[model samples]
Target chain A: MEGIGIWGVPLAIFAGAIRVSTPFIFVSLGESITERSGRINLGLEGTLVFGAMTAYAVAVMSNSPWLGVLAAMATGAVFGLIHGFICKFPKVNDIAIGIAMMQFGLGLAFFLGKPFIQPVAPHLPSIALGGWSSSPQIQSALNINVLFIIGALLAVALWWAFKNTRVGLILRVVGDSSDAARAMGLNPDTVRLLATAVGGSLAAVGGAYLSLFYPGSWNEGISSGQGLMAVALVIFARWNPIGCFLAALLFGGAGALGPALQSVGVTQGYYLFYAAPYVLTLVILVVTSSPTRSLAGAPGALSITK
Target chain B: MTIEANIPTLPPLSAQSGNLRPILEWLARRAEPVAISLGAILTGLALFSIFITVVGKSPIDLFKLMYTGGFGSWFSIQNSLSRAAPLLLTALCVALPARLGLVIIGGEGAVVLGGVAAAAAALPLTGSVSPIIVLVVMAIAGMIMGGIWIGMVGVLRHYRGVNETIASLLMAYIAIALMNHFIEGPLRDPASLNKPSTTPLPAEYMLGSIPGMDVNWGLVIGILACIVSWILIEATSFGFAARIAGGNVRAAQIQGLPVGRLIVGFTALAGSFAGLAGMVEVAAVQGSANASLAAGYGYTGILVAFLARHNPLAIIPVAILLGGIDASGGLIQRRMGLPDATVLVLQGTLFVVILFCETFYGRFKIFNPDLWKRTA
Candidate 1:
């Protein structure tokens, strides 16, 4: 903030994008997986919040951040399992079921997280990538977390896997048509169940990143619908992992607009800028989506896009 | 829509039983939702009881407190009723759009913006006009704001093929942000420093309650809205067209139905009810627009709408029942050392179970009306 002047806004926004975009990257990538498997889990918001609570609580108890991340991943998987299991039943609406699961996860988290609100937990460490910079602002801005690097690599790996792996082929097949997957002697339900669980776990990692890094706190207001926003981001990304990564950064930048502008003394009506991400999401959906046809790259069996 | 539960083709009772078979079949068809929903509640309560027991709290005491707080007495009943008022309107928000094959979860945003709009409208005309006129203007302003907000979701769904559920929810977050902008910056009452709020309505301008009642006028308004909505959907041609579109958009298009207009109209109408709920809160409860306007009545309305199977008439009892559970939250917390979110847990469990029960409908032969026909 000091000595940066008006140039601080864009620099701050760029730095903030990298910092805030980690959770979006993880959740959108996870949602991309679940959507590709033809089951959209809108309850990932609940999973994200519950994962934050779990990670913070576990980190406080075990005095280990990595253990907290693992614990969060475990609970997220369980949440997805429950969602996937119930949705497997005929006549059940997956979207509604996701809403129910979200409420359940939120209730469970708040109830159990009552005790851990006060205890400060050990947080994840960050790598200083701006050692060459003499300015403290730039240096501090470049102090990126280890989880973010892992997320970037995960995006590349997932993109490759979706193209080259056998598991990817099965997932794509099941997503396209349950009947065709069954014809190929594959259990669509099982594949979707596993995909949803993996998606849930990745979403939890995003939550862990929030609690154990970035803001580094555990509270009820830790998430501001970012979990839900990831659902839209997945669509904006066209279901590609690399696209999801880029989309996350874009949304992250949009989200940071309000705070970044305010830092440079442009506080007038800046709260409206806080809405930039949502407006951007709406615009993206409007531009890309169509009334008569399915979105390009959307899985054939996905209930939502249809 | 979820309200379209198919009637059983077979009679639930045998003709060899008695002359009461027809009556029994009628009862069976009508009572199917009631019976299943009741079972879901019991199962949910049982699950919650297990959680309570595991946490070392006595489940019996919690239930007793809930009864006293929610429905065991007249005062609690009034409390529940007052709470149910807004739920009635917000439930309509979900129920209405649902008829057009849309899921609009952003009703909360509509409610928030509606309150802001109502407050803004009243601020300019408060002293210039009569109180009743102010109130009427408030309602219309709220409705218009809410309608436009949710109508956008409808337009997006119809014109752009956007997923209404996610789109609506995104709008809600955006609404909340805009609301904060107005509340914190533009509409802040200079005298009120601690909690940011709009200019308060004068005491005479506030909505009063019914005679010999603790509840405000919002409850009656909510009830009337529900009845009108029921008639609109069940007895009117507009409702029929909406239903046809809901059943199949392609078929409706083929039949030359104005499917796009129907979608937008239903969603706008639904958003109106939710917006009205926000106006009620401003006029009857809070007396001003503030952050509390985003008090989650919209989300709870979703639960009520679903539990009622999206039937406007059924939304009445369902809203009251859910409101009672919400009213009992504080009691459960004080008596059982459990957090108030215990109610949310119960609600979530019930919602899940009720949805799962959809699979059971038309599966059991005992609930079938065609059985009596065969036996006869």
Candidate 2:
């Protein structure tokens, strides 16, 4: 491979980060909303995979990638509904149920996705942000997906809504204290159920991005635990949507490090770089965690914090 | 609450029933878990049938194929038993840590690392060492690596207040990555060009089949490990302390039990069992550490542990049951034209329904002798 200039690696990483972080951004933002409501849906891994399959299958059948995204969102919401309803019952551990749901989703996807694997679906449209640049490398690298822009806007909107909207306040109140919500005559279960449903839909959008955009395809190995990592990303971001977006970019950069280095002909420990997100998440968790006290900004009623 | 007062008064049940009272009480005491678990299994089956029906396959045919492939003949039973061997140990990995109220789901990491460590240990003594000595060294290496792998999760949870579930899962991912790095790099055998793997064990050093059985010694070892773990958990003071800590960590701490030590020790032991399963796979089955070593035994073990309610002894039967389900996958695919993921769907459904049924526990007064006394 011809060596790119010294600045090429960094530039490549930046471009890769943008291309790769879309799913992370959506999933983490969704998880942030869900966690903000005091419930953890570890099963998002399943939701993400199922979404990828649904999106790919629908896009192939309908010849419309946008419809694929919508179908995935609907499927994801149904999964979230199942999770939320089951978790509503007393003594049902959300985390375990999440794992079970993950398996179910993955199994269902693989079983159903057998045919879609061989067919090609239309890729999601992307903007030629690097059209002005002379370099093809930069041009291709900077071609941003529309979903990335939408994800950024979603993050900003969520951040603003969490502080300014009455609906957001109700969600926070329900998350902070179920008793308080109940005292105010609000059914905490309903609120949480809805929050989880919305979260699930958002996460499916992330999956649609994966299958219909960057590395666009339907495969069992397409998602390397991105859904699960979103949970950790949410924590590191302190449950803030914009922070999730930024953290996702950081993770995407980490994920891109190996490919960028390999492009630059530095192949040593390439496989290890795939673990960068997980390791970073672990470090962040350890640093933020306190043995005697819950992390700052953690919802009062969150099972993880307790 | 209202129903208790409405019960018809007759002779005290214990006095009237005589010997039957004790038997009935015993049955009632155990009935809750049995009934709830059976209900969960049936519900899961029903849901899975609907899924199967939706997919244009007959659920009756699928179930029939599962039974025939899993338990129909002597050969099928042997296959299921062989598959259940690793699960026995891996399930213990979850069951033991669960005794300390920790959810350590990363046993897969330990299994992968342990297999790598065992392979590395055996490579040096390929020809010179006694086969038995080589096996011992491999087991020790595997156990230590596995122990440290899971022990870190315990230490992080207890000292740093990290969530055991997430931390362990992340560690598992890291461990798999590291294993891949080694298998594809430093440890790669030149002969393994198509698929990266460590050096295979010599034929003489490989674990052999048991007498009159097609299954390897791993099955026996797994059974023995379960027996030992059961005794350790149910009959010892340390186990008693661990159970107490599991119930209430503050109470255990107040009672001067070393809660941190218990957590780390139990997790380490659990990891070691999982690690042993890895070694057994490499030694008795695969004969080398490779990508295949990460064959999801760790994940399946989670289902087994939960289905068994994290009971060490109960894990034996549960592991076998799941193993049968797994063994039937290929046959179901071949015969019914359904995908191999069919069994996975069943397992996942069972897992969800079973966890949901946890709410039913302590709900029925008939299952609680204490409630009966109140009525009396």
Candidate 3:
């Protein structure tokens, strides 16, 4: 305490930011892709929770955390597949469908995952980026999860791909206008279907990071609104993948406020501090939204911005 | 079904003896929604039965237990009605805003805050004031608090173009957090060591059951609220304007309709119902504001509203159906050794199947009268 002095709180928060932001990054990036393909999946929260359950159960059963990740991705893809297929029908409200899917996913997860709650699953490995630092505090603070690094790189790659790739062009065309995508001879529905599945899979990876990594565990209270928060994060990022990475970091930092305060013995109103991310997101929305104009870079056909 | 009975014969007939198109068209139009809802609910139940069968539980036993526990006996019916009381109001929370084309899913926020407000408002009035005065004050306080909480979502949506669904959800999280803060901090009753709730109301002031039944006054209030909401939506110019606005906001605005006010008013009114539910809980059930006030009734209310197709009158039957399912949960859990989440799964399956069935509306040409019009 004496050696670290005033730096301990900020250091803990910095580490907390990186650790906490991993899930946000993955979910938001997935949401961005889905939105870019002219659809939105609010049920990602359900997917995230179910993914965590699947990951934890699989890891415990198979004795390998990576297998758990694959299992979660597969389950999440199926959830998306159902959502995408149902939404493709005429007059079906995707938002309402998303809500229904969320409820169904949550119910199924809770019912099925009840068995795996007590077991100890394998944890995901982390990278030691601070070998140069001798202090145990510094070493622990700089220890980063592999998923975080992968998510960061994926963000960069997605940003570049959205600009340069033919797939990106088709997605954008489908998102902006189905008629235009049809003119280009692309089936917008099929593209959106794939995009949604990919999005759900990415969100599941985020969930795998949750149960297999930091604060890792299989329980009902594992998710504290991270899935829903990703929607806000994607909106704040203006649908940019790189922006999602940055925004996730910001959200993660805010999420660390409570624990950081607790570390310093300022424990009063801790729950309020836990609400910082939501408050921040709400404030961002209130400030940035305009009635006369749609959000800049928002997918043209996105139901949310419309 | 009631709507079908109440509506006068609108299609003019030539009485040409052989022309049955108009009559058939009218009946088809009237029957489509009922058929869809019924079909979807059955399909959902079938899916759940398969899941249950796969798990080695007999679906027949489950449904039988559900019927016995929910609607079989007078006591069970009373239990179902009691639970349905809160849902009636909370369903309005989702239904009203829906008429304005806003999907607000955060009624839970209003419910918690409303309950807290009711308990807090009643705290000082307990001993000195009469029970009736205290109850009225608490109800009003609860409504106002809930109104403000959800009304803020409508305000944000209209004034700032914020997405109502996300805004309402975020606010609900914030509201719950705030409720917890207050309950565990300033409002904590020192004597309530285990639960950490506000001071409980006096026994006399607590809401009592109706004279002849085990059901509380909340049921009657809920029924009345539904009727009033129906009248408001169906019989008034305000509701007409709201319907027009919901159909097309741009068109409504061009016609000089008060779209913004309608949005705010309907949301606030809807939220007040959810708040009143919280108030009812505090007064009749919990006797204080506590963590239980944030129960998933708000979420279930969303299902009720959607099942009813956002119609206030239709919410009555839907809420009762959901309430019966909820009441039977305990029975199913006890009799079958199934977990409590079975009900949630059933609900989720039903909700998904219903949403999928939405594509079926107007799909059948028989339901569309224009297609049946023969050029005489």
* Winner by TM-score between candidate 3 and candidate 1: 1
Candidate with best TM-score: 2
Candidate 2 lDDT over residue span B2-58, tens digit each: 566466864465445665767878999898899999998999999999989998889
- Separate DockQ for every predicted complex: 0.69, 0.70, 0.70
RMSD of 2: 2.8
Across A36-133, the per-residue lDDT of candidate 3 in tens digits comes to: 99999988988998999999999999999999999999999999999899999998888888888888988888888888888999999999999998
Q: How does model 3 score by TM-score?
A: 0.93
- Ordered from best to worst DockQ, the candidate numbers read 2, 3, 1
Q: iRMS for model 1?
A: 1.4
**Per-residue accuracy of model 3 over B1-376 as CA lDDT, tens digit each:** 3243345754554567347765777788899998888899899999999999999999999999999989999999999999899999999999988988889889999999999999999998899999999999999999999999999899998999988998988888888888888888888888888897999998999988999999989998898999999899889999999999998999999999999999999999999999999999999999999999988788778878888899988999888988888899899888999977788789889999998999998787767665554434
Off by over 4 Å in 3: A130-136, B1-22, B373-376
Error of 2 at B340 (Å): 1.7
What ranges in model 1 sit over 4 Å off?
B1-20, B192-194, B371-373
Candidate 1, lDDT over the whole model: 0.88
Model 1 chain B: lowest-lDDT 10 consecutive positions: B1-10
lDDT of 1 by residue, B1-376 (tens): 1222246453444546768766888988977777877787888889889988998888898888888889988999999999899999999999998988888888999999999999999999888889999999999999999999999899889989988987898899899999989988899787767888999999888888988999999999999999999999999999999989888988999999999899899988899889999999999999999999999899878878877778899899988988898899988888777888888887788888888777777766667765434553
